[model samples]
Target: MVRKHERLATAWAAGVAGVVFALLMAAVIVLVRVALPGGADGGDVTTDSGQRSAVRTALALLPFAGIAFLWFMGALREQAGEGEDRFVSTVFLGSGLIFVATLFAAAAAAGSVLGESPQSSDFGRRLTYTLLTTYAMRMAAVFIITTSTIGRRLGVLPRPLVVLGYLSGLALLVMGANVPWSELIFPVWALVLSLNILWGRRPASARPAAPA
Candidate 1:
């Protein structure tokens, strides 16, 4: 059976996810604006000031996705009831935590690349760019896969949404060869998943209501 605290937790998580999705969507807009004006000639793609700024903004936006994923997990856990196994919950939580960590790493790397003497050793440039891009895509993969798994098990998200989640996960997995595509996919999928979580009805708490 679902406990009162568990139900409350799920509702809170969903609310937080909704707010975070808005923030992340805003950040994506800011990033696109910042990145579009400059052509490829200014500097190395990774070290370019405009690109760095965009990456930083994107990184800052990732917490929303993380929060959304966490809330989805919370909802799933509550729905699973007492018979629900803990392994899936742990996987969801673990993946969400790692996703957040990767975002932090991406932010740091972007900052380093954008700092003064912007173009440093080629190795550092490549490393930073790789970290920012690769990790972002990987985190997207983790988010979609884990969430789809949890949603399937708990029957929280709609069927179409779950299918989209799987497709998004597969796209991210293959996105390594297409940087721009990965950038687009991550934010778009995150928004979709966030909306699904936020709009779903919350599981009921066990606590009885006081007399009206």
Candidate 2:
């Protein structure tokens, strides 16, 4: 009974955290994209007060998003228990940490634009874009791919969802830097995965055995 309750709690934690992280991240991405539709080289974002406010809001929400993501990741890992592969788990953990670090770095870079001259603002904006689209999204892709692989190996995710994960990961890997708003894919994937957890769709083998 204790173990069953523990598993239920962990699942709920994973599902709730994932949903929170996804919603926060999606909002941040939308706010940032709307505020900076022209990308780094298109326009001077510092001149517009509205854009600056939007960017500030996005930056403010980023830390909370990162925190929720960490919780989601930890809870998902806990669900894997002793069956998790050491090598894949290492990649999963590394990618997640790197994604958060890069995300923070990008937010910092974006924040610097508010206090800088037009000349330096351009540099900061470019740096922010590079960190977010190129580095952070790449790490996100790796995390998604590794997670899907782990889920498949553990029989925790269905085949359709696994295929979707692979496709989403690949899209982010190849087109994330070039495509505007592509970062939303990560949050969408998280939302889907979280919903699956909440629905309790796992195979019987993946569940804890009853206390005899």
Best-performing candidate as measured by lDDT: 2
TM-score of each: 0.67, 0.93
lDDT of 2 at 14: 96
True lDDT of residue 135, candidate 2: 95
Candidate 2: residue 157 Cα off by (Å): 0.8
Tens-digit lDDT string for candidate 2 (81-163): 88999999999999999999999999999987786588767887889889988999999999999999999999999999999
Worst 10 residues of 1 by lDDT: 36-45
After TM-score superposition, what is the CA distance of residue 86 in candidate 2 from its true location, in Å? 0.5
Q: Which whole-number lDDT from 0 to 100 does residue 42 have in model 2?
A: 56
